[model samples]
Target: MAEEQPFALQRHEKLMERLRLHGAVRVRELADALGVSELTIRRDIAALADRGLLTRVHGGATLPTVLDETPARRRRASAPAFTIGMVVPSLDFYWPQVVNGARSAAAAHGVHIQLRGSSYDQAEDRRQILRLVESGQVQGLLLAPSLEGPGVAELIDWIGGLSVPAVFVEREPPRWTPTPRPLEWVRSDHALGLELAVRHLHAFGHRRIGLVLSKGSPTSAHLAAGWHRACEELDLPDDFVVRESVALNVPGHREIIGGIVDRCRRDRITALVVHSDPDAISVAQYLTEQGASIPDDMALVSYDDEVAHLAHPALTAVRPPKTTVGRTAVDMMMARLLEGRNRPVQRTLVLPELVIRASSITSSWQRETPPAG
Candidate 1:
């Protein structure tokens, strides 16, 4: 489950989006759309009204600037200014929140988001992107293309020469010389997220820690870099990094996990920081079957927060700010459309948040707020 603060923030984002899209939002409609009670929506409206972000009407709330405007003017103001095409690999797991955030921001700004699902293949990425671009319906594009392939450079160049503005969401172009039109991107700083995990383990009195990065992931390289830097900074024992994955899908994963557990026992490694939640839980479950106690025998921290809270001991995790990245991608595209060539090329990195849980802490230890950086 999401925390109250993040949940309320998401509600406010949706509320403002509704207000912007329709110039006003009825309480009943908002309750249904947001899956909250009318009373909760009213409270939200009241809170927004106090902040002067919206004005409470008879049964709804209107944009702060729209309450006094004429009907015709309001309609003109609320009309969609742009339609953006988006292509992403999957609508499940990590990308759904991103799409939702982009949709919320698009609605809030009177922009439309037309999404297309594609398989995570370079060929499919090209097909989906070219289909949207050649259709000429979209004023801009928000794309998350497959970044690892022989033709990646060609793909980037093709996208760079497009007629409409394009923003890469959660993807970066591989190292290349500057084209006449450089691509812009917004992604989470996973490297720093890995550092957060190591620092948290260090503060929890772990001196000999291990890192297990997921194989065949774009994010693994970043996590490995972070692991190396954090180990150097913390002056912890080294030579314990495992780059390959032990996911259930891998053949002979039991042996792989057993070797990992045996290495920890030999090295006296008390804690581990893993790239993702599924892999972390696999290791944790294996350890449990071996009669090991979490935190007592082996504490664990996972990088992705997708299913961390669902773990048996409730894994501590680094939660990437995926929604914020999505919202920012749209906002950046809007700025590019408005500013045209005057806008500087941007490569923005948003930070991930660390959420502490039982797996990484002792019973007597209270959860401390994570560092802002």
Candidate 2:
């Protein structure tokens, strides 16, 4: 016989087993089998649902998707049940997980998602949204557009005036003006994510922490807000802040990353929070070139989890729940279709988690020793 584990762990394990065997599990049945109350089973299901491990239905939980089900079968079965058009900023990096999560939820609810890719440019965002709107086949939309650019106001008004139900994914409404039409939104709490990173570095004995933000990222403002707030709350110095976009492939990019590395070295900054994985990778490389060992010499934490694991040391990162965000967006759209204007506008902020790795485990800072030519 195997040794017993904690009750919650045991219950969750058993639930997974049941889902694998039956494709779904009812709360009453699970409660009876586990000798627990139905309420306990419901709570467990809710927790599992939040983690994207399972999808909660009226009276039971189901496996998120049929792993063996082919796309052809899924499309054939779901055949325009409730067509939803989705426009996202990019098909590569970060957004794919969001799309997959939405697809899973659509499959569960017997709906279909029509996906379109766009760039960060306002014009491009509008083009994608218009393409979806003109399709005539879609009754709803999920959009992640350039909410910060000059065209944002016009775009928001256009979306608000749309005849179909729409939901914003990974974007928030402008607080500056009252929306022409009520809109629903779902996004990761990037501000909270920054605070999580700061706390993690602080826990590891890093005091003089620094932050580097990608210039045009939508989440940068929220992250900076969190960073500053955390610094104030924790009584840590917050003087070292860099706000620039570094394109490693561009000419003169080396100097920008080199400058950042030099500043950190001179300021005795023990830890740094870098937004997005690509820039973080560049900084890590530049720092290594300066003879600074990651974690040992300077602790590093990347904000976006998308490709952070690919870094040399496998970065500690704040991971937005991309999959869950996608899945919930679809769910919100479904609710809007069913409830119409009867349901209150939903604005959800999903919490992000810090994935600890080798890059942020040092107990003390080790100053960089520049490499000899």
Candidate 3:
């Protein structure tokens, strides 16, 4: 009991800190972070709830709210009242988890989400958004519109001017200058995600590391920022970077990847962090075809976990909390609809998770994970 007291106290402290930061805490996440069992985390949550520290919700605990934020209580006694229109650049890849997460939260709150798939084009995003708005079916919006190009500033203003409340899913408002209105957003801290990857490789005795970014991705800028900042902090070289789409279908992809490989050899880079799985997998396939080995020849860490495990060597990856981002956006939407502008503007930043696997680790690496889940 005495030995357990200190550990329990530490766990309680962490739970409170996370709740204060993100407004909620998940049981599975807490267990993983603390290296404890889910049952143990539940018990800790119970103890905390008994102290009026938090309100227990399904699979998690949240800040105590008078309306009872738990889904068990909020589960539609009747049909939903409000409908939220959701638009994403792609229905596939990174957006699905986020959409599913929104669906989960919306179901709990007895709300409907009208989803529309758009491309990365700002004009297409506007067209989709306008169609949803012009239909007069939605009272709120959960948008993942293109945050690039010259027209983005005007788009941000237009979204803000809409009669309904809006939440940005995995997107942020303009950063170059302030918008006419304070926007609400939730996104994975991709910068910090890259930092995690860089630091992880550094600890594994990798002195020189490179970063390869997918061209034209909004997330790429954040990843690059993180790579530079982390490298600077670690005193690692920041010279080796490739800012191009090196995925399989891209024109001259083989030559593009070949150049990257040749550069790594010339620079003696021992580790590389590639943004997104397709690019990472391309590099992996090319390396294998050339008879080089992963982690042995060049340790590889991919940015997105989507399909990273499906790669030949099973890449270690930075998994952005996509579901959490979506859930949080909906939660904020609920707050906005309920309290209106009385509630403070929220621009939440959720961190990404690093899933260790075969590609980024050798036998001697301490924090190793199973090759397949």
Candidate 4:
């Protein structure tokens, strides 16, 4: 006879289908349907909850509420008594985790989050902000910007005029330009995290290290500065620094990795540090296809840790304290909402940790040599 399916997988499949069909399901009912104890069902639900897949209620679970897509003007005009707005470039993997943290914190304070995405378009970002502010829908904002091109200056100008209290997340305002008076920010220390990645490679005896950047953005600038700091600290020559910028898409990533490898070949770079896990995995695949073995011919490291472990050769990455950033951003926003908008401005900076994995190791060429007799 065939063996019974694993309890975890069985429960996950049933939970997903139930959530899709019924929008929510109680723990006891789910357990009875799957022929498992309620305790078993609770564990299954907890696993999903950890990933922000479903919301756990007192006795069961429910689907996350879909964000209202009403026009910003309309939303602002009929804004709730206490509503917070989250302005992000797009609702991708990164933003969602931050949003989850914000939502959880907001729920505790009896507040709601009005999340808006800009599709990485600066104009749209301005429009969304204006709608929220003019309609008076949001009392505060948690902004994670995508200041990619010429429009950033304009976007910043608009945000400065919004009057409501705001906190910038993920990316900080530019250095040369003075931000509109009294703008506050909460961000991961990209410089510190990237420095950690580079130092990890250097400790493994990799002198020639390459970097992949997302060009034309302030975020990339911080990452580049960190890479340079590491190289400078180690006294590596300028030629050892190979930088390549690519768009944030599958095709763009493919092209960027190809460019990185090309730079590696010309410069004899034996290691690479990327800005994100997705890019690290892409570069690893490209290197493997080109007959280079990981931790043998080259070493690799990256910034974000979420996708690292899932790669073929688990990646060594600098894990940002994303949950903390989320929690902090929400806390700041809530303070603005509760304590009146005139409260003293605050800034929170979160440091990330380095996680070592199989993808990065001492370069084979750097392995210890036997002592002579």
lDDT (CA) per prediction: 0.83, 0.84, 0.86, 0.72
Model 1 lDDT at residue 86 = 95
Predictions ranked by TM-score, top down?
A: 3, 1, 2, 4
Leading candidate by TM-score: 3
For residues 1-373, write the lDDT of model 2, one tens digit per residue.
1233236645776777788779999989999999999998997786556445677788998877655333323323414446899999999988999999999998877778999999988888878888888888787999998888576787888888987878999999786545666888999999999999999999778899999998878889999999999999999988898998765764776898888878887999989999888888888888888888888888999998888999888999999999999999999997666445545688999999999988998634323433469
- lDDT by residue (126-177, candidate 1, tens digit) is 8998899899778789999888858888788888888877899988787563
lDDT of 4 by residue, 157-267 (tens): 667677786788886776444555467788888888888988887877778887776444456777788878878898875454444444235656667667667767888
What are the TM-scores, per candidate, against the unseen true structure?
A: 0.76, 0.75, 0.79, 0.69
TM-score of 4: 0.69
Off by over 4 Å in 3: 1-74, 175-181, 363-373
Candidate 2, residue 220: how far the Cα is off, in Å = 0.8
The numbered model that scores best in lDDT is 3
Off by over 4 Å in 1: 1-78, 363-373
lDDT, candidate 2, equals 0.84
2 or 4, greater by TM-score: 2
| lDDT digits (tens) for residues 257-289 of candidate 3 | 999999999999999999879999999999999
Native-referenced Cα lDDT, model 1: 0.83
